[model samples]
Target: MEFDKNFKTHSFRATFITDLLKEVPIHIAKDIVGHEVVSSTEIYYRSSLTKKDSLKILNSVDTLRFN
Candidate 1:
């Protein structure tokens, strides 16, 4: 059996950290990834929200009804 040419064990580290960031706080993600500094982890995840996306979220929030 052979793996893909680009398959490096460490290649998924960035994606792992990025997905982890989506589910956990930055400090937690940093600790999970074993980075001594948060700055090193900061470059891995991006929120990337556009103006339209923000407005969509705001509109969705407006639809919430509390009893």
Candidate 2:
């Protein structure tokens, strides 16, 4: 068995950190990734939200009926 050029250690690291960031806080993600600086982790997981995407999230929030 052989791996291709797309297979790199950093790819796995990037994916692992990216998935972790989605569920956990940035500080925790930074600790899991073992970065001394949170900025580095922020660079990996920062996503730009489109207007439509923002509206969807806001609409979801508005639909919540708190007791």
Candidate 3:
């Protein structure tokens, strides 16, 4: 599929880091990117998750079962 013209190589990095944040600890994600601080890597997670994305994440949690 053709991505947007605005898409750049850094976009892939951001997406990868964002996905990593969903599955792994912040420290691990930061290490993977060779960042000195977890806060640096967290920028990708925060920016990638917009208001609409936040709602989608909450909606996905509705399907889970808990004790």
Tell me the deviation in Å of residue 12 in model 1: 1.3
Cα RMSD of predicted structure 2: 4.5
Against the true structure, whose TM-score is highest?
Answer: 2
TM-score of 1: 0.56
lDDT of 1 by residue, 1-67 (tens): 9999999856577678878888999998989888989998987765668999999988888887431
User: Candidate 3, residues 19-60: lDDT per residue as tens digits?
Assistant: 888888889999999999978887777455689988988878
How many clashes in candidate 3?
Answer: 0
Model 3: clashing residue pairs? none
TM-score ranking, best first: 2, 3, 1
Give the 10-residue window scoring lowest on summed lDDT in candidate 2. 41-50
- Error (Å) of candidate 2 at residue 15 is 0.5
Pick by TM-score: 1 or 3, better one: 3
In candidate 2, position 29 carries an lDDT of 89
lDDT of 1 at 40: 86
Off by over 4 Å in 1: 46-67
| Lowest-sum lDDT 10-residue window in model 3 | 58-67
For all predicted structures, in order, the TM-scores are 0.56, 0.61, 0.58
